[model samples]
Structures are given as structure tokens and as C-alpha cells.
Target chain A: MSAPFYIGYNAKMPPATAAFLRRWVVALFVAGAGVAVALAGLQHRYGDGQFEFGIVKSFDGIISESPYPNLIVRRPIGTDAKDVRSRVLLVAPGKHGAQELVRGLEGRAVTLQGSLITRDNQSMIEVRPGTIAVQAAAVAGDDGVPLGNFTLRGEIVDSKCYFGVMKPGNLKPHKACAIRCISGGCPPVLVVRDADGMAVYFVLAGSDGGAVSSDVLDKIAEPLEITGEVERQDNVLVLKAEPGTYRRLE
Target chain B: MTLAYQAISWNRQKRVYDTVMAGGVLTFLAVFVVTGLVLHSEITAEALLIRALGTGAFLLLNVVLSIGPLCRVDPRFLPMLYNRRHMGVATFLLGAAHGGFALVQFHALGDVNPLVSVLTGNTDVQRLSEFPFEWFGLFALVLLFLMAATSHDFWLANLTAPVWKALHMGVYLAYAALVLHVVLGVLQAETSPWLVGVLGLGMAWILGLHVFTGWREWCGDREHAGATADGFVEVCAVADIPENRARVVTLGGERVAVFRYDGKVSALSSVCRHQNGPLGEGCVVDGFVTCPWHGYQYLPETGASPPPFTESVPTFAVKIVMGQVWVHPRPNAPGTRVEPAKIG
Candidate 1:
């Protein structure tokens, strides 16, 4: 086998050509380095419309189901029941074993310190890692009356996009992208309608009340009939259901 | 050629090639991101970044693949083939960025492992439209990585030309994978006809180039028509070869570069010692037959590199009769001196 011809390039070339090649090399390096710097400086993380990094603000509220096992804290207006409905809750960064921590504090008022961010006019407290603390024992607050074992239907969507990243994160068109978001550990939320004919979201949980993230990977963006007991945790709604109870319609 | 191997035996050409490629990549990212933000005004910066890097790598790979066939059809494009590995390595690095960032964004912070999630997340392969296409991209990237990893001269020397060529030829398979990846991934949702059109045209162009050049070569070989008794055959008229350039012809079952230079004609084996390049396509530069592929030089009289450069090719016995060049079919020993036949 003969040695490769390109073992060396232009070993014997005219001085003029060599100079031209060298100058071209310099031009390339200058242009490349300048553009690289611009790109590096332009680096940024765009949170799905739902997340915004902000100052650490402490808030007190009752945990409620937003849809399917996600936590939304409801701040009380007064002892009167009519004013409690005016509150909203947003939770995020739900990291640091947050799925389990929020479940254990169900129906309890908790004070959490984290960056407060709003999405679609809905507020969510992005709890910093390991900053959640319970203010009192799990006690029933003046949340709205039980909405009962509502057997509602809608597609389960990953909340990351539904809340902000994508405008309409549910239905057939967004199915594959939504499924991927959920399977990657984004919280899954069930988009359904209430008896009053209002669109409501429930943070879904497994029947055993554990993180149903892995369990719902196959059910994303697919319409399903989910039967579960809905409870008001502060301002959010939580749907507790098992894998077998949810039947696929399509 | 150096006796020892460094990471890269840097040259001005290679330096220029890499620098220009780097500039292209960075400029592409800047333009893509800025335009996406301006036109759509909705896509996240991160998503634009991923798309930019992904597209950059894809386009560069296609460019790398086209360079070879392009050079075959027109020797003017041969310079693109020199230091071509720099482009391959840059493409791989860009691909790595896209793959890594995508893994973190779409696959990480989930309950399952990121890599595992990509595999298990899309079990809906039953529907052809929804079949998991990321897997194809992953496979292609792996093949590209292997090719890029072994692109250096050290590997080429160890593996030999044929083996090295075969290994790098895996780029075609990667190209196939990339085509499917695009068709199944972005094409699944993209509404633009231009993207699909560009893809179809790119594939057609590449396939057409290969077929066109292959057919041309086959026809040229079949029509040699220079089989003469006693091994001497008329390859072409002396006027057929351009001054200081070669006329490649198959005479006596050997490809020979018959050069008309300095009012004399010299016949030498057309296959370059380095990479078996078609030396016939090259031109004489500064008193040396310079291989167009990488500028490897040889003394037309001796079929050997100038002093201190040991590479040599077989010289052929040539004689001019009535302004026509006739070459003996049998090759002379490598580096053998053969007096040029003076032209009228």
C-alpha cells in the first residue's frame, strides 16, 4: 500500500501561493472567532411561557389540585367562602423530591420560599431545591366543596408546555411533543371540564398516590376517561387515579 | 509526507479550511437564531439553537459527500477534497452539541434516564408517520463519530488506503439515516415545501453525480481501442494534450498520464502514489506534475518526487511518430528515467 498523497499538502509550492493561503487562513480565523463570541454572548434559556426566574418570595396557601396531582396553593381571602374562590396557585421546579413532599402535605397550608413566576396570568411558585416547609399539620381548609368522583374526559398533557411553552398543549397535533415532555419528567396534567362546564386542570397522581410520571408515558395526548376523587388543595385540584381505572377511547 | 505523526500536520490550506468552516457554523447559528426570533417571534432561543446546529451539521455532511464526485466531474473542485477531514470533524462537533442539548431539553429532568427516555418514550412505531425517528439520527451520529474519530493520517496510515476509504465510505449510510431522520422528524410537522424540495433535490443531485461520473468512466475504459500488437499503441494525437497538462488514456491495460510539457511529451502511470488519485487530472506546476488532489509533485521525466521526497510512479516508454504519441503497454520500473519524445 502506497502512503497517502495528502500526508503533506503543497510541500513544494511557489512562495506567492503559500502567502495567499496563509492570508486566507487568517481571514477565516478572525471571522470565525468573532461570530463564535457573538453566539456565546447570545446564550439564553427561554422558559416556556410558564416559567420565569425571579426573586425568592415566600407565600402561604392551601395546596389544591391544579389537575392530576400537581400542587396549587389557595390563599384565603377571609373566613367567608365566597372570597376563597378568588385565589390561584402556581408551583414549579417541582424538583428535590417535590412530588412526594407535596403529596404528604396534601390539604395542609404550607409556607414555601422560591422564585415566583406567572404564566398565562396564572401564578406558580418555583420552589427552590429543599426550601418547602409545612406551616401546620395536614388540616382541611375552607377549600371549595368536594366536586365528587368526577368521571371527566380529556387528553393528559405535560404541564411544561400547556402552561407556557406551547399555547395549546393538548389534542392530536401536539400529541407526540407533549408525550415526550411528560416522559422526560415534566408533570402530567389532565385537561378536563367541570360540571359547571368550565375547563379545569387536575394534576394527576397514581391510585397509590405516588408520582405517576412513568405510568402515564403511554397515555399522553390521548383522550381517556379518568375517574378519580377530586379534592381542593388550597386553590388547585388533585385527581387521584390508578392505571386500570383510566380507559383509552382512541 | 512527514516521517512522524503529530495530532495534525498543520498546513496553510488546512488552517484556512477549518477556520472558514468554523466561521460558517457560528455565522449560521447567529443568523438562524436572529431570524427565527424576528420572523416567528415565538420560538424559544434554545429551540432555534438546536435547529441551527442540527441543520449546520446536516448541510456540511452533504457538502463533504459531494466534494468527491464533484472533483471527478470537474478537477477545479479538487481543492475541496484536500483537508476535507477538517469539515467532517467540525460537523461531528456541531452534531454533538445538538444531540447533547436536545438530550438535556427533551429527555432530561424526567423520571427515566434521558437516553432511555428517547428510546422508550416513543413506542408508537406502529404508525409509520409517528415512528420514532430520533433513533435514526442517533445511529447516524454514531457512525459519523466513528468516521470523524479515525479521520486523521495516523489511522489512515495504519488502516491503509483501501481500508481507510471503505471506513469513511460509511458516510453514505449516515446520509441515508439523516434523510430518514429529516423526513420522519421535522417533515412530520413542517409545513414548508421548500425544505422537502431542497432535500429531494440534494439527494437527486448526489445520486445523479455518482451515476453520471460512473457511466462516463465505464464508457471511457470500454472505448480505449488502443490494443496494439507488440504492446505499443497509439493513445492520442500529440495535439490532444494541452500544453503543460496530461491526456489520460488506457493503453496496454494501464492508465497513463501522457504530459505535453516544454515542447516534449512524457508518459507516466496516471495513478498517484498518494491515495491513488488521478494524476492525469492535474497540471504541471513550477516544473513538477502537481497532483490536483493534494499538490503532491513528481518529476515528469523520472515519475518520481523531487529530491528528499521518495514517492514515485511507474514511467512508460513513449515515442512520437508523425505527431502522434504511442506508448508501450508495459510499465517501466518506478522512478525510471525516460527521455521525453520531442514534439514538432
Candidate 2:
């Protein structure tokens, strides 16, 4: 008998053609499943970043506006007198910094509600809108301890996203979003990894210790060598460098 | 082909094809997400969904593209081509979903409009390593949308076969953009050998299939420079074709489908008026040359669809000399009828 011909408008496919298609369709499904497993298995686990999402908690701390908004809270379990404060970076919800929220409250104690975002040792707060209230009058906070100037190589990422807003959010794939975040007032951070692949986050600041989010916009998500003065304010590190002096490393 | 266009004819075969396709897509997603959660528990739901949909769309498009060459290389694969527009439309929906999720996840909630951000987000065009790969994905998504929107026969008839075929050829361009999208985007960060190897294999498979089919077609067409007599070319013997079937011969750089049916022979343009499908590969069903790809029908003698259907292809004059079929090298205008030559 001649091979069965297939007419699509016909209600039934020829038996031979139907049988043939059944085999091929089975093979296609098997192949598709295999591809899905391979693709999913091959992905790199970028980091264990956590975004608390909607779990808002109240935090009382000294809110600083300069060099990007941050909340310096007292360590609940302080071991060393020198590290009694934990600097929790503050960002407004949705790709923005808390600068506007903390504009006039610099060095003042305040309580704010927000979700916590944490990756390794770095912590940030996605501040809830209209949640800040003055708790105490202006009080002096720690003048950052100077760590000697050093030349460091790292990739700059938006602090808001790199902390936990997104996972696998610190490389070429996340470059555009990082740029958008930084441009939209999310603080830019320089991420330097040690020889052991452990990342060290530094809040990027202009050489004179001011916000560098706008200055470092063009260099986000690229490898660069920056010669800067590093300082420790509470547990957070800040890298002070002139954006223009940063060299793009090939 | 129907005389009038409906949203969809919804035949049993089409329903089966779509069901199987949906099942395959759902299975892929279930496996990908479940396996991802097992492997990387820390992955965000949004991130997993985006990657799964994007990769799924990419793989589905690869399958959609391979179907054509697969059919050409082996006729048993014809059933896959029957409702391929269903796959095309599914691919577009998958792609649109992926793009939409990516836009919301990465670009929305930002200061600028999400659409504007997609275009202007990463101005790293100067550097190859940091090129704005999002633009490539956007380009592919737009093309897939165009193809899916016009996949129905109504558009094919209104646009004309050549114009419609040209528009659908954008699938290749979309595929190319997606290649760049994967290469410059995820691959840059993923950097896994398995990922790179699988991507290379998919590309090689597509390229190899097309090349092999093209080579076979070239070999078949090369036999055209044979003996000629009195403005006719000796194509093949009448015995070479089976009853209700055609023998395609390339004459004057055009493929002609010479059909032998009911003890008479008629020749028509081998190119189907719908999507340029090879009419010669089709069989005479109910006295009409039914396209194997989509079942678009044309009269064997006149090369025109029956009344209420306006599609037509060029016709050629044929005469049976001895037991051999001689066909004129030139073609008559589309829909022009020439009397069929008797067998004896």
C-alpha cells in the first residue's frame, strides 16, 4: 500500500501518518524535558541574597543622608566596644535611595519601618513610605575610622539590587537594571572579592565623602581599578574615590 | 483551505496538535521550576520564572524552525507541519510572556517608563562584552509578535503568498537576534560549559538540517539540463510517477509539478500559492493537487483554486511522446488552463 497522505482539514489523519507523528511527538517531549533539565542544572547559583519582601519591621537608628542614606543602629549583641553599631544601608522602595526620606534627619535618631535585604554580611532596608518618625534630637555619630588608601579592583553594582532586591544581580545580565537603579538614586557600591571569592561591599562615595551614585553611573557592572581611601563606619565600609580617576580594566 | 476565513477551523488534528504542544510546554516548565528549586533553593521566584520562560521560548523556537527542514528531509515529518502555525503562535505567546516579565522585574518601578528604560537602560553599545543585549531580545519579541498576529490564512490571502512568505522569513532574523540575546546576555554571566555546549549544539543542529535539505534540493534541481526537442524538455518517463502523484522537474530555473492522474498528465508550478510549499510533494486528492503543508488546493489542469478561493500558481503545457513526458520550459500565466495530455 502507498504511504498515507495527511490532509489537515480532514477529521482524521491517516493511520500510518498518525503513528509516525506519535513517535516523533514523544521524542520531541523527551528531548524538550532533557533540555530543560540541562539548562536549569547549568545555571550558576549567583548568591544567597534575601529580600524580606513584604515583611516590614521597625528599626530605630541614627539616619544619615550624606554619602547615601543609611541607618546606624546599635548592635543588640555587641561584643567589641569598637563595633557597637551596625550600619544598615537604607533605600526607598522601588529602585530609589532613602535620601529624600532622611534629608533633614541627618545625625538624628528616628524609627522607620521597612523590609530587610541581606546578602552575606551586607544588610539594607527597603524603607516603607511615610514610616519615619523622629525619636530623639540630633546626636553625634561615629566619625568613620580611616582604613589606609589602597588601589582595588572591583565591579560597581547598585547597592539596592546587589544586596537582595534581585538574585544573580551583579553581572553582565543585570547591567541594565543596575544602571537604572543607580540612575534612579539607588546607591552605587563597589564589590571587591578576595582571592577566596568572598565579596567585600563598599559604599561608593566621591573623594570628598559625598554620594557618587550619579558619578559612577557610566561604570556600573564593569571591572574597574579604583584608587581610593577606604573607611569603616560602624560595620560598613565606604570607598571614597573620584569617579573620573577610576580606570576601566580591560 | 476554506472558502471563507474563520477564527480557526478547529479540526480534530489541530486540537490534538495544540493539546500535545500545551502538555509539552507545561511539562517543560514544571520540570525546570521544580528542578531549579531543588538545585538552588535560594533562587527568587521572579528570577526562576523569567529564566524558565526565556529559555523555554528559545527552545520552542528552535523546534518550530527545525520542523520545516525536518519535513523537507523526510516526508514522515509532514504531520508536524500540518498545524505549525499553532506552534508559531505558541512560541510568540511564550516570548511575549518572557519579555513582559523581564520588563516588569528589571525595568518597572524605576523612575523612567518601563518601555523607555528597556531601550535606554544599558548604553554599553561601545563594548562588545557589555553590549545592550536587551535590545536584541526586544527586537526578536517584536518580530515574533508580527508573525503570530498574521499567522491566519486571512492575512496570507490578503498579503499574497510572496509577501507573506517574506514577512514570515523574519523568524530567521528573530532567531538570530535571540542567539545574540542569549550569547551577550545570560551566557556572559552564566559562564557554564554545559550551557555553552548545549547552545552550540542547538545552532549546529539547525544549520546542519538546513544545509542537508538544501543540498538534496540542489541535487534534484541539477538534473534539468537534459535532452530538449521542439521547445520542450524531456523531464522523465510517464512511468516514473505514481498514479495521483507528481514528478517535480526544474525547467528554466523554475520547478514544475507534472501530475499524472486518471490516465492524463498536467503540469503546474511546484510552488504552492500558500507559503511556497512544494506542491510536487503533495498528492492529488479529490481531483485537486492538495498542498502537503497546509492542504491548500489547486486544479491540476488550471493551477487555480476552485471558485470562492482565488489562489493560483503558474501552469505549463505537457505532451506525452512515446512513454516519455515532455513539458514546455516556459510557464503560462497563473490560473491559465492547458488541456491535459492523454496517456495512450
- What's the fnat for candidate 1, on a 0 to 1 scale? 0.09
How close to the true structure is residue B71 of candidate 2, measured as C-alpha lDDT? Answer: 91
State residue B208's C-alpha deviation in candidate 1, in Å. Answer: 3.8
Residue pair clashes in candidate 2 = none
Query: lDDT per residue, candidate 2, B180-274, as tens digits?
Result: 99999999899888899999999999999999998999988874875799999999999998999999989998999999999999999999978
Q: lDDT for each of the candidates?
A: 0.69, 0.89
Q: Give per-residue CA lDDT, model 1, range B1-344, as digits (tens).
A: 56577888787766766776777677667766665576555455667777778877887787788788877865445556777888888888888888887776666665567788677767777766666778888998998899999997779778887998888889999999989887887666563566677678778978998899888887766536764646778888998888888888886567889998999999999988777888887778777898877677899999999988778999998988888888887899999999999998
lDDT of 1 by residue, A1-250 (tens): 2112232376444454445546755664554444434333332223235444556777676554323223434433223444344344344452222344465566676777766434433444555656667777776535444567878797687776666554334553345556666654556778775687556778787755555776886777666899987765555566889866789874
TM-score of each model, paired residue for residue: 0.77, 0.97
- Tens-place lDDT digits, model 2, residues A1-250: 4567888889998888888888888988899899889898889656788889989999988888868888888873123345377888889988777878889898999999999988888888999989999989998766889998999999999988887889887888898889889988888988999999999988889989998877787898889999999998878888999999999999
lDDT of 1 at B142: 95
Name the top DockQ candidate.
Answer: 2
Interface RMSD of each: 7.9, 1.0
